[model samples]
Target: MFKMKEKWRYLKTEDKTAYANMAIDRAVLVANSECKVSPTVRFFTWNPPAISIGYFQSLEDEVNLEMCKNIGVDYVRRITGGGAVYHESELTYSIVIPESHPQVPKNIMESYGRICGAVIKGLKNLGINSNYIPVNDIIADGKKISGNAQTRKLKTVLQHGTILTDVDVNKMFLLLKVPDEKIKDKLIADVKQRVTSIKHILGDDINFNETAKAMKAGFEEEFNVDLVEGQLTSYEKELAKRFEIEFFGSKQWNHRR
Candidate 1:
């Protein structure tokens, strides 16, 4: 049996979604500096639906805020670099582990492969074939079903991703800025061609809660560890509150270049 050198924390957040996700990422980054947690895996969903832009992306250039507000979608910025993504209709997963953790890979692509392997295993459990595409996407038949990003610090690594259960192709187009003049038509066609969902593959509605549970089990098996449900440590809670105020809840950080 493989033994993990640190404790594993399993956290499920009900509908806190964007802020909670960002808060947990920050908490894990700080916690990694203080202790060796085998790794923390969080399963979460969004409420009041939101759009998250990548770290280096220009909010004005990448997102149409007026449309977002009109549709009651909250706009937030991610700490990782990637394109903007609409967050509804997806199950999100975030993992936090120390950089020195045995399961944590050294190179970025290798790390993505390692983390996405768990996702592959999870999808296979549902009889859906999936594979990891380099640089961080989980694909089925060349169409992306999930997208992931990672951030590394001195002692910690935070990797997070979204698994599509369903997506609104039209709404997604309305929320983001596309360069082409015929973007409305192009975006709709492109998304239909390039993105897919569990519902589309399984020929039925996916039960997200079951999927989340399967994902947690997949990680536990992959890492060879017992997953114990836990809450944020007092320190993590404090940091989360602070992070919500300083970074996640701030317009400055969201708009920062």
Candidate 2:
């Protein structure tokens, strides 16, 4: 029997506070697990900027909370395991799909390579050559341009990541705590050498929508599916609010190692 053609939801770009963004991703994952929504791809940007740490990372060890607050940057812990990331001047995307889906590899590393391939295609759309460097990074010209993280819950997989349009390594270092202040300068210099952004490569600033558009097309092509534009359902909205209050925005959740 021939398989049915696939169509995934494409949520266009929106700017949101850090808590709301994380809440929405989780809400969508839950909704998709219940089979209430189609496999979805959504893009968004951070408002007022923020720092998101991995699930297993210690908050105090990873982030300088006082500096974050003083500089009006939001901070939160993610449900996915990885290093901390400073969200700003970039496009963030989340994709929700079932683990049993044929296109999704059961092996975590292969799955990362497959999903990160979509991002590589997206960069190509913008006339940039990039490659996927496992376990979860995309690079351009030997410098990292994107970082991704994933989690499997309720038998569903949610992978989200950032595609940097511009980078400010200096500002990011200020908000992230260093194990020893002595190596701070060397670390920053090393990062600057190892990381890059769209603007740095293209010599132009690509706005959020344009970057998102490229990424959407990338997923469609990589998965061989149509991406239909959509919005959050009422149920998703309500769930996001609850998630924000109970988890993402809560002091207890963010502070919990």
Candidate 3:
């Protein structure tokens, strides 16, 4: 059985835009590699709202650009692959581990499953039963409660996921063009009925801090490792500053179709 090392760091960041959050994830990965920082887990949220398209998705196909601008929502591309996602009323979690680490699974799907298992445990603690769907989703009653993506480089892997605490289903439908022929209205209605949130499932508002603490505890218990509260290393901070100016904040990267 694989076991993680004792050294693990946890970071909880202030709310940021989607692009900056993604850039920070990459910067942390680079910093970990260069500084040999221990495996890291980060929790964060978005502010001013944003929409993120998957690494390989076409913006025109996935987003209504005019609608987004009119609504004051920013748009950016993710470093990981998945369908487009609207990032509001969501808490995002990311874990970066060296590929050489024993706890890091060899297969991508296995890695996702392991990380999502922590989320499942966390939600269960709050009385919201959730299950990990293969390939990177956490589902509750057949509707997606969370979605994840992964990126690997230089013998390091970064896995991140979004936990949908609350979402605007109607606005989501409006911003992204759903294939009308794929699913009939009845099936769509069924999906909406099944998809739910902590608030929906438990009949109470789920606070972000409570959720984050629960998730951190779940990770600690699942991995059987002590988590040290930490901040971004100097290297990571510098890299994030550079990345924000050059790529994440650039129109070329954001508008690149």
Candidate 4:
């Protein structure tokens, strides 16, 4: 005799500032670890065009704050470490699982690979032939369509990534700093060549909602679990607010070395 596995919570949240979004993800991670909520598959959007630097990134080095201000772009630091990402017209998803979950791997790289594999599967469900490229990226036709980051906290593993509905290389370059001006043109060209989007691949027939549906199906199938729609608990919301005030919204936290 065997027991049936539990279903995952599917959190469909509205667009929010970069700060609130990251704070919520961290709060969910903590809540799940403390047995407050079921493991979650959260999908969200960024309201204004935003820039998020990796937790360990030097904001001064990677981002041009003046440019962000001039363009009215929101910015925040993520708890999970990764390269800087400009959030414009993209869909973001986060998965929170207890560290002891059977699906999670003990090895860090293996954990990354496991999450990226689910992402690849999600892209595939969207009609894109995407593949997990070793670490934390999902590529299609040799160009990156998705990039992910992971972190562990309170005995839980949280992984999040973005699926570009469309890529704005020019805008992205405006926010992220390039070391050499001489090679700036070349760098932009190289980036355009290396990154892709769902709209680019599937044309106008596909959209954000459709892409999200595909990803939801992909994760459910990949993990062999169901996605039951849910919302953040009051405790998680309060914790997120504290995180926003103390960390995501604070210059000290964003610029901390």
Question: lDDT tens string, model 4, 1-257?
Answer: 88686799999876799989989998998889989899899888998779998989899999999999999998899998989999988889999999899988988889988887777788888778988886788889889989999999888999999988898999999989999978999999999999999888887546567777888988887888989887899999999999999999898988895
Clashing residue pairs in candidate 1 are none
Q: What lDDT tens digits, residue by residue, belong to model 3 across residues 105-125?
A: 898889888888888987887
lDDT of each: 0.83, 0.94, 0.82, 0.89
Candidate 1 lDDT tens digits, 75-144:
8888888878899888888888888888888888798889998888878877789999988899986899
lDDT agreement of model 1 with the native: 0.83
lDDT of 1 at 172: 90
Model 1 residue 119 CA deviation (Å) reads: 0.9
| Quality of model 2 by C-alpha lDDT | 0.94
Using lDDT, give the best candidate's number.
Answer: 2
Candidate 2 TM-score to native:
0.98
lDDT of 2 by residue, 86-134 (tens): 9999999999999999989999999999999999999999999999998
- How well does each candidate superpose onto the true structure, as a TM-score? 0.94, 0.98, 0.92, 0.97
For model 3, name the residue pairs that clash.
none
Q: Which stretches of candidate 4 lie over 4 Å from their true place?
A: 2-5
Which candidate would rank higher by lDDT, 2 or 4? 2
Q: Against the hidden true structure, what lDDT does model 3 obtain?
A: 0.82
